[model samples]
Structures are given as structure tokens and as C-alpha cells.
Target: MQPQFQSMQTTGSIAVGQNRVLRNTYLMLAVSMVPTLIGALVGIQMRFSFFAGSPLVSFLVFMGVAWGFMWGIEKNKNSGLGVALLLGFTFFMGLMLSRVLQVALGFSNGGSIIAMAAGGTAATFFVLSSIAATTKRDFSGMSSFLTVGAIVLLLAIVANIFLQIPGLYLAISAGIALLSAAWMLYDIQNIVRGGETNYVSASLSVYLNLYNLFVSLINLLMALTGQRE
Candidate 1:
């Protein structure tokens, strides 16, 4: 009887810890948005376009900086520096996203497409996050599969810099949106199941998933709705 009681207690304690982690992750996720907004506004105002002459050059530069920022954030995850780094990374991402915004704003229905995409993304996030928070089923098994899919997709995207295939670019954008949505579910579940104990890392993972999803959705909308002046 004592052993049974102890096991139950341990399980309860773990559940509580996971709830706390999820709560903190959520709070930090909300806080990180300010920086993103600031970055977007600044970049747009500055007419920031990365390596306009070479998409490949821009892609490499962006990826290098993004990964470097993520590394720094992880290494400092336990300190105040982690918070700063995470905000910095989000700001950089927002700046990167501004190019898409710039192009989208050029379209007649650009504003409409952007609004639809944002609303759709919010709806998707809400549904997936709710499932992660309330569902009892474990989803960790999908992590390996999702990781492989993401890597393959990334390579394809990188290759497209030179290939410049419109069809392939559309496929990759659609794939990324789907994968990142799935990843958001997985990451949220990891927090719910106690697989992710650090809010810093957890927030970073979710932030990236959301950011990627946003970018992919924007790309899809642009492809569908963009018209020149």
C-alpha cells in the first residue's frame, strides 16, 4: 500500500511540474511578441531587403544568424541572458519576415491575404494547443519523424535557391506550414507531459514553430493572391 501511494504521489508531482512549465512557457511566449513587432516596424521603415541580388546569399546569411542566436539562447537558458537572447532572435526573425510583408503589401489584396493568414494561424494554434493541454495521449513518438521531415524540407528549400522552381517552392511552403503546425502540437504536448522542463527552451521551440508556420502561410498566400501594379 505504501509503495502504491508513493507512486501516485510521484505522478502527481510530475503533473504539477509540467503544468508549471507550460504556464511559464506561455507567459514568455506572449512577452516575446513585443520584440517581434518592434523589429518588423523598424525593418519595414528601413526598407530592409536581405541580399536582394541573391536569394541563396540571403538564405545562408539568415540561417547562419538564426542558428547562432538560438545557440546563444540555449547556452544561456538558465540566466537572464537567455531571455534577452530569445527576444533578440525573435526581433531578427521579425525583420526577416518584413521582406515578405513588403512584397505582400504591394498586392491589391495583400492586406486581405495577410489578415486571412493571421486569423487562420491563430485558429490553428488555438486548436492544436488546446489538444496538447487537455489530451491524455502521448505524442513524443512523432518527434523523430517530424525532425526528419523538417530536415528534408529544409534541404529542398535551400536547393531551391538555385533551382528556382515555382512548383517546388510552393510544395516546400505548404509542407513547412503543415510540419510546423504538427510540431506546435508536439512541443506543447512535451510541456504538458513533462518532457520539456525548461520554459526557456520550450518557448524557443514553440516560437520557432509559430514563426515558421507564419512564414509558410504568408508564402502560400502570396503565391495565390499576389498581383503586380
Candidate 2:
């Protein structure tokens, strides 16, 4: 992920341009969400999934498709193709989320848990983003820490596919939520300070962070507040 971020071309000394890019990126991010929600809603009704009973298979499939789309987007960010690919990727992610959404909606308090998680995610984003824009202190330093944290969280999640431990899942979820929050801050701060100039790439990075945070929070809330009937 860190390498992917660094791979973007940087324009020098244009805070105004960066700000415009950031603003447009956010607008695109907001607009990009529509397809995602639609996809998730349809997925819930259709119960669509790429795999079952094989986490490894599912993981590999998802990675392959997602990375392929990401590569294409990066290659074509200067064209309309990037926006199309980004939205397409979001829809794919939304479809992927249905499995968790299905399990979550099964709990008696599922809807409440989902709402709370959404609220929490929104609040976290607002607060972190505000600090990122206002503070003169650099959060670029957090990149390394957040990257390391994310790698560990990813490894733990992969390990759990075999271990199948509840405790491990909880820990990974918590770590991911934290890392996602950190990532959001880092990405947003970079945007504000002009470290990130490509609106398409910026939107993609922040969108992924938001998606991870939302999923992690939803999982945590379901475990803690869900009431099985």
C-alpha cells in the first residue's frame, strides 16, 4: 500500500492545485459511494458472493480482481477510465461486503449495530480529517507506523483463516479499525498539505481506508451488541 501511494506522480509546490484536487477527490469519493451502496443493497437481496467454504480461495480471487482494477485505474488516471474503474471497484467491494452484511442483519439488534458503526465511522473521519487540515505538524511520520500496523493486521487476518480463533478475530478487527483511522488521517493530511496531488489516486486511498474502517466497526459492533434470536 505504501509503495502504491508513493508510485503516484507528484506535482511540485502547488498548494492551491492540491487543495482543488483534494476537494474534487472528496466529491468524487462521495459520488463514487452511490454505486457502492446500490451494489451492497442488491447483493443483500441476491446473496451474491464469489466464494464460500474457502477463505483462501475467496481472498485470492478478491485480491486478483481488485488489484487488477487498481492497476488499470492507476494507468489511466489522466482519463475518464480511472473514474469508471474506481466506481466499478467500489461496486465489487460492496458486493463482497454482502456476506458480512447478511450475517450482521441476522442479529436481533443488527440494524442498530449497523447504524452505530456508520455513525462511529463518520465521526472518526470528521475528527481526524479536521485535525489533519488544521494542524501544521506533519502526520507524514504516521505513514510508516500505520503501514506497519496495517501489515500486522493483514497478517493476523490471514493467519486466522487457519486458526479460526474468535479472540484473534476480535483483536484483528480492533487493530484494523485503529489502523484505518490512522490511515484516513494520514491520507487526508497529505491532501491538505499537497503531498498528494492526484485526485483519482487520493480518492482511491481514502475510500479503501473508509471501507476498512466501516467494516471493522460493523464487525465489532455486531459482536458486542448483536442479540441473536
Candidate 3:
């Protein structure tokens, strides 16, 4: 009876720890968005264009920088520097995002389309996150499949840089949106199940998921409903 009681205590403690981590992760995720919004506004005002001359070269450079930031953040995940690095990375991403927003704003109904995409993304996040929090099923098993899908999507994106196929671009956007939603579910469940204990790392994972989902949704919405001025 003592042994069983001890086991129950341990489980309860772990659940508390996981809940704390999830709470902190959510707080950090919300805070990180402030820098992202600032960066996007600044970029839009400056007419920032990442792919200035060569799309392929600019993309390669961007990927290198992004990975470097991720590496730094992971290496310092236990320290305050991790949070700083994560914010910086999000700012960079927001700057990149401004290009899309600029293009979207070029359409006659661009603002409405952007709003619709944002609403849809928020709805998707709410549903997936709620399921992750309440459902007892393990989603960690989906990691390997999701990783393969991400690799395939990355390869397709690189190919499209040269192919410049509009249809394939839209298809890839749809694929990314689906994958992002799946990843968010998997990631949030990891937090709920205590598989991921570090709030900093967890927030970064979820933030990336949200960013990708938003971008992909915008792309699809603009394609389907955008009206040129």
C-alpha cells in the first residue's frame, strides 16, 4: 500500500510540473508575438524584401541564418539568453512575413482576406490546442511521419524556386497548413504529457507551428479570394 501511494504521489507531482511548464510556455508564446508584430510593422514601413535579386540564393541564405538562430536558442534553452534569441528569431521571421503581407495588401480586398486567414488560423489553433489538453491519446508517435512530410515539403519549396509553378506553390501552401496543424497537436500533447519539460523550447516549437500555419493560411486565402485593384 505504501508503494502504491508513493507512485500516486509521484504522478501527481509530475502532472503539476507539466501544467506549470504549459502555463509558462503559453505566456512566453504570447510575449514573443509582440516583437514579431513590431518587426513586421517596421519591415512593411521600410518595404523590406528578403529576396532582392535571386530567390534561390536569398532563400538559402535565409535558411542558414534561421538555423543558426535555432541552434543558438537550443543551446541556451536553460538560460535567459534563450528567450532573447527566440524573440530575435521571431522578429526575423516577421520581417520575412512582411513581404507576403505587402503582396496581400496589394489586392483590393487584401485586408479582409488577411483578416479571414487570421480568424481561420486562430480557430484552428484553439481547436487543436483544446484537444491536446483534454485528450489522453499520445501523439508523439506521429513525429516520424511529420518529420518526413516536412522534408518533402522543404524539397518541394526549393524546387519551386526554379520551376515557378503557381499551381505547385498553392499546393505546397495547403500541405504546409495541414502539417503545421498536425505539428501543433503533436507538440501541445507533448507538453501535456510531460514529454517536454522546458518551457523555452516548447514555446519555440509551438511558435514556429503557429507562424507556419498563419503564413500558409494567408497564401491559400489570397489565392482563392484576392481581387487585384
Candidate 4:
């Protein structure tokens, strides 16, 4: 009876810690968005073009920088530096985003389309996060499948850069949207299930999921509903 009581107390304490981690992750995620918006606005204002030269070279450089940031964040996941790195990475991502936003804003009804995409992404995040928090089903099995899908998608993207196939572009956009949603669900659930204890790392994962989801949704909406001048 005494050992059973101790086990129950241990379980409760673990639950409390997990809840704290989840709450902190949400807080950090919200804070990170400010820098992202600022970066995007600044890039748009300056007419920044990462791909001003060769697209392939630009892409390789971007990947190298992005991966370096992610590595830094992971390495410092237990410290304040991790949060800072995550925010910085998001800002870089936002700068990358300006290219798409510039293209999106080119359409006559671009503002409305952008709003719709944002709304859709928000709704999707709400739904997925709610399910992740409330559902008892295990999402652990999704990691491997999502990883494989992402690799295939990455290869497709590189191929399309040279192939320049419109249909494949649309397909990739759709794939990204779907994959991001699934990854978000899996990540949130990992936190909820106590598999992810570091708020910084968890926030970085979730932030990327949201960022990609928003970008992919914007691309899909533009391709499907954009009105040109």
C-alpha cells in the first residue's frame, strides 16, 4: 500500500512537469512569431532576394544556414540560448518567406487569398493541437512515415527546381501542407506524452511545422484561387 501511494505521487509529479513544459513551449512559440513577422516585413521592404543568382546555389546556401541554426538550437536546448537560436531561425525563415509573399501579393486579390491561407493554417493548427491534447491515441508511430514522406518531398522539390513543372509544383505544395499538419500533430502529442521535455526544442519543432504549413497553404491557395491583374 505504501509503495502504491508513492507510485501515484510520482505519476502526479511527472504530469505536473509535463504540463509546465507544454505551457512554456506555447509561450515561447507565441513570442517567436514576433521576430518572424518583423523579419518578413523587413525583407519585403528591402526587396530581399535569396535566389537573385543561381537558384540551386541559393537553395544550397539556405539549407546550409538553416541546418546550422537548427543544430545550434538542439545543442543548447536546455539553456536560454536555445530559445534565442530558435527565434533567430524563425526570423531567417521569415526572410525566406518574403519571396513567396511578394509573389502572392502580385495577384489582384492577393490580400484576400493571403488572409484565407492564414485563416486556414490557424484553423488547422487549432484542430490538430486540440486533438493532440485530448486524444488518447498514440501518435508515436507517425515519425518514421513522416520522415520518409518528407525526404521524398525534398527530392521532388530539387527536381522541380530544374524541371519547372507546374503540376509538380502544385503537388509539392499539397504534400507540404499535408505533411506539416501531420508533423504538427505528432510533435504536440510528443510533448503531451512526455516524450519531449525541453520546451525550447519542442517549440522549435512546432514552429517549423506551423511555418511550413502556412507557406504551403499560401502556395496552394494562390495557385487555386489567385486572381491576376
TM-score of each: 0.94, 0.92, 0.98, 0.98
lDDT of 1: 0.90
lDDT of 3 at 143: 99
Query: RMSD per prediction, one decimal?
Result: 1.5, 6.8, 0.9, 0.8
Q: Please write out the lDDT profile of model 1 over residues 1-229, one tens digit for every residue.
A: 9999999999999988988999999899999988888888888899998868788887888889999999999999999999999999999988988888888889988888778888888888899999988898888999899999999998998888889999999999999999999999999998887888999999999999888888889899989877766
Residue 77's lDDT in candidate 1? 98
Winner of 1 and 2 under TM-score:
1
lDDT of 4 by residue, 24-68 (tens): 999998999998998899889989889999889998999999999
Per-residue accuracy of model 2 over 36-82 as CA lDDT, tens digit each: 89889989999886677698878877889999999998998988999
Q: Report residue 45 deviation for candidate 1 (angstroms).
A: 0.4
Best by lDDT: 3
Misplaced by over 4 Å in model 1 are 1-8, 227-229
**Residue 44, model 4, lDDT:** 93
Model 2 off-target regions past 4 Å?
1-13
Ranking by lDDT: 3, 4, 1, 2
Runs off by more than 4 Å, candidate 4: none
lDDT of 2 at 164: 93
